[model samples]
Target: MRHLISIAAFIATCAVLVWVFLPDPVPVETAPITRGDVTVRVEAEGEARVREVVVISAPITGLLQRVTLHPGDAVTAGQVLAQIGPVTPALLDSRARAVAESTAAAAAAAVELARSQLVQAEASLTFARAEADRTRALFERAALSQRMLDDAVLAERTAEATLASARANLAVREKELDSAKAMLNGDYAEDTACCIHVTSPVTGRILGVRTEDEQVLQAGTPIMEVGDLQDLEIMVSVLSREAVNIAEGAEATITGWGGPDLAARVERVEPGATTKISALGIEEQRVEVRLSLLAPAPPALGHGFRVTARITIDMAQNILRVPVSALFRSKGDWAVYSVEDGKAALQIVSLGRRNDEFAEVLDGLTEGATVIVHPADTVENGSAVEEKPLIGG
Candidate 1:
């Protein structure tokens, strides 16, 4: 009985010793190194703008009539948007009235002279015709020479041409008289005002009105702006140094534009750089990167809408990758705690590229190898680890 009791005690002691000496598994989350594809992107905040923007302007120097259309009003081509009349003249006094009357009288006299000249030309033409008829009859009867008949015919044609010229002169004189009368009454008065209707040149919505009321404006003054909402492009301004990495035809992803993520492509990188004040109040050398939408942009995406853009600068396919969280500095080299046989194994990895979530593993890791993400400070090489599935896999 003593021997059996001693054996039982030794066994219990051995069990306690084994339980105390054995290491406990460290709690950790891990993900297997993946071999698939990864994309490297450069991100920026961008602004949406119409591909084409047009400013409507007054074509003539005149009073700018009140614009009834407000901002964001849809318009079509050739739609009359505003009407401008010639500037109304100041009040006319006695001396001004006298001068105007004298000018009107001169115009009337010019018209009378033209009418008299036309009447004279008509009389001369009639006389020439009679003479030509008589000369032709005499020539047929052998009573007059051929040269005389020819001369009479020529005179008749000349007189007819003169009469036509006089008629043209009379028309000009009448127009001049009307113009003088209009000026005397008032420039652009109710009866004789020359009103010009300004029409929309294209189909679009009104962006803004430069002149809102009955303000006098000079010729070519901007009155309004129009731009198609459907035709939209993304303008991303990036640092000039970073722009060198962006190339035309790179795939761009746009988000936060009041719709689904829009697929786009880099259409152009401006050759010139502009200076812009950043949020930090530092002057930044920036270049514009224009993005062309791959699909039709949403109508809600209007001009100056804010958006975020991610441009893919590089891509690696079928390359081994690991979560960026798994990477840590060890012994002056990039390293990770790779799980092997349920123990954290220190690994020195050669990296190629990295993005937000993953880093390209050029060497020192293989597919299906699990790596501890955000390894704790207490964890070290050969530490027993308990693996938890990474969130979202």
Candidate 2:
């Protein structure tokens, strides 16, 4: 009887120890539903750009002379940027002189063509001037209306400009003819002849110089890019599907520009989509969104500065919300493991607009209600739970 009592007491002590050593509280973390404001936004990477980019091109074909301007150099309107002059005439040999004679003949024919055009332009101008004089006299006598008189005056001015342009063309053709003759005589002095100065069209800093060295270029060849640094905009490429939600005048918060956050607004959403290779080597359909800064941007930030954009598409105030991890699909319906009396109770909940961090709870979950975030498979309805310290507390 003494052995039986001792054994029973020892078994009771072992049972107590087993109860004390049970796994600590399932090792699960918990969060509570709360009332707060939530902003629905699409985050994207973007780059800073100029509001207006201008390209200064070579207006006339010639050999480009010394270009003193460099990138980032301040320039003003009408300031000379570069010089273009005639190409060098090659030294004449017996074969070269024969080629030069052919060129001279072609230049002479061009001069004749230019002279005929000048004569036609002069005749038109003379007629226009005579008609204008007659119209002015009639207007003075109240025979012609002011509109007719103005028309005649405009016609005369246009004709005069045409004639002057024709005369200039004739002079250029004559010079070409003379130069051709000089080339036939083995004169290579055209290389160092007078040059045409290329002037800046706008007051801004040079962004890029396409031709840094002297070289022969054709007319309309691009030379440099100039833009005002103070005038800036942003270019954000977002997924085409997400771009549909964005509209003009939507608010945007720009960050990661190596400065403080800046306020901006969407100016335009491009109508077209383009294919782009993502960082992960996946192809994505993307659309460009243009935004204008609401406040002045940082002075140090220049064109092509990398940035991150958070565009707010929707919002809600004083909405009941919970961490999105607490929600799970149950029978094709949204459900959550609600903790009540320290037990996991399955509760069906309605949801509304959601963001990356939180989901808006419409029903079944209330403020101060504890919900199991990422509940384990064993955490089911009517199961006892020991809540660990709150996540991210």
Candidate 3:
């Protein structure tokens, strides 16, 4: 019995020594390499806007009547928008009145002279026509030459042209007389119906009323803004570095405008860069990227509405990829801890494109391979590892 007890004691002591010398396995989280579509996207806040914003302005300086139109009011072409009444003329002094009366008298004399000239022209044209007829008759009877007949016809044409000119001159003189008389009488008249009607030159909804109250305004003063909702588009500003990668016609996904996600496409990229201050107060060179909605926008989406745009700058399909958290820098190259047979093997990997969540694997990885995610500093090459179960798994 004493010899058996000594042998059992020696076996237990050897077992403890072996366990103390063995290395502990490092706990690690692992993820599988996937083969699927990988997309590189640039995201930024954007605003919806009308492509064409028209500002209605006053065409003349006058008393602007109160505008009855409001924002979102529908308007059509040639619709009367507002009325600008002519300002009341100042009462003329005695000398001014005298000058105006003299001008009116001169205009009246000019009208009389023009009317006499027009009557003379009419008589001349009638005589020319008679001569032309007589010359043609004489030429047919062989009493006149073809040249004489041509001369008479030319004379008649000239007389007709003169008659038309005299009639136009007489009409101009009559209008001048009327204008002079108006200038003299309007200064003294108490009541005159005179106003310019402002009309809408487009078909759209009023975006805003710039001058809604009655007041005096100068010509070219803005009255209101009009825009069509059907021409709504999106405008996005991105960092200049990212803008270089965005191409025209690239697809984008829009969200956060109180509606479902909508699809859009890049229409253009503005050539100029604008300076903008970021939330951190840093100055950034921002470039504008204009996008057109692929479908009609929701009714709630209108001008100046805020939205988020995720633009696809690059894409790769059916490619091997892994989570971005698995990648780390090593010796000036990208590296990852690839799991092989319960061991972490440090691998240098070639990558193509990367986004926030995943990266495209160009080489040094295969689909279905396991990689350590967010490896700790203690995890090194040739380290023994064990899969750490996720919480609640």
Candidate 4:
């Protein structure tokens, strides 16, 4: 009876020990959940560009006799850039002499002719008045016949007509003399040999110098380019489907092309979509978006510099944030497992802003709550769990 009793006791003790020490239903490894401020952002890639680019060209075709400036030279408005050609000494002298002689002779002739015409017109007018006065006096005194008075009046009229014609001729001569003077004063002289100096249209650094010494340039050919480096913008191409959600004034973070990350804002979303052929020859619709750098542009930022950009179309701050993998659909509603006391308690959650990595927890979860990421499909609610480090932690 004693041995049997001792055996029963030992069996009972072993059962108790097994119940106490047997591995607590091997707890599945889980990551410790921690939360802080989370930021949601959209990522994109693009290139830096100047806000304004001006292409300079010669207004007339001529030999580029001199290029006083070269590429990268700083210039101001109206500053002379280059001189084409100078007037030849012989031609200049010839033009000067011809203009001088012609002008002097023409001026003398004009003055003499105008004086003569004025004197004649004055004499005619005086004679006509005197004859009319004499005719009136004769009629009053009854000493002259009416036919004689009339004949005298006709004579006066003829003299007046002649004076008028002379005055008109004098005016024409005066105009001709003025024109002759202008031509003789080198106004009509062709300065074909003189260099046509090109001037800067705007204050900027010359980006290019197309012509060297004595190169002939055609009209409207671009000779140089000028741009304001201070004012810079970024142009990015986005997938057509993604572009629809982007709007003007959206915030963007630009990075990776040589400079530090920069903050930019969308200036415009181009309306037109273009078809792009991929390496696989698949047609893809894309749109170009222009972004103006809000921050001061770095000196290293240059035109066509490729960059990676993250455009923030949506954002939220100071919210309960959880890893996106922790979110799962439960009966058409979003749910997550809140790990507490080494167990996952399935809890439905209301969510707010979401980004590529995290989802904002609006309700049913608090900051610092441990949540299971990528919970197993077989894992049941209120199941035991063991904490494990995340891969990238």
Per-residue CA lDDT of candidate 2, range 1-393, in tens?
Answer: 999999999999999999998655555689988888888998899999878788888888888976778988999989888888887756777887888899999999999999999999999999999999999999999998999999999999999999999999999999999988877875655445668888888887898899878899899998888888889899999999999999899999999888888999999999999999999999999999999998776778888889999998989999999888888999999999988888889999999989987889988888998889989998878887989857483
Q: How should the candidates be ordered by TM-score, best one leading? A: 2, 1, 3, 4
Off by over 4 Å in 2: 1-22, 98-183, 191-193, 328-333, 374-384, 391-393
Which candidate would rank higher by lDDT, 3 or 4?
A: 3
**Model 1 lDDT tens row, 1-393:** 999999999999999999999988999999989887889999999999889889999999998888999989999999999989887677788898899889999999999999999999999999999999999999999999989999999999999999999999999999999988987888436537757999998998998888889988899999999988888999999999989999999999999877889999999999999999999999999999999999887877888899999999999888889999999998899999988898999999999989988999989998899999989987899999999979985
Off by over 4 Å in 4: 1-38, 65-71, 82-194, 209-214, 278-282, 325-352, 362-368, 374-385, 389-393
TM-score of 2: 0.72
- Candidate 4 per-residue lDDT over residues 1-393, each given as its tens digit: 999999999999999998997545324444444565666565666777777778777777766666667866788988887665543223337767777777768777876887797788779878887988899799889988899788878878888887888878787887777766655554445665666777877887776777656676777877777776678888888888888888789989888877677888989999999998977999989899998888778877766678987877776666668788888999999998877787778999998878878887778887667777877865678676776746774
| Per-model TM-score versus the true fold | 0.69, 0.72, 0.67, 0.56
Give the CA lDDT, 0 to 100, for residue 375 in model 3: 94
CA lDDT, candidate 3, residue 16? 94
- List of clashing residue pairs for candidate 1: none
lDDT of 3: 0.91
Candidate 3 stretches with Cα past 4 Å from truth are: 1-27, 88-191, 376-385, 388-393
**Candidate 2 total steric clashes:** 0
Which pairs clash (backbone N, Cα, C closer than 3 Å) in model 2? none
TM-score leader? 2
**Model 4: how far is 233 from its true place, Å?**
1.4
- The residue pairs that clash in candidate 4, if any, are 30-388, 42-311, 44-309, 85-194, 85-195
What are the clash counts of all predictions, listed in order? 0, 0, 0, 5
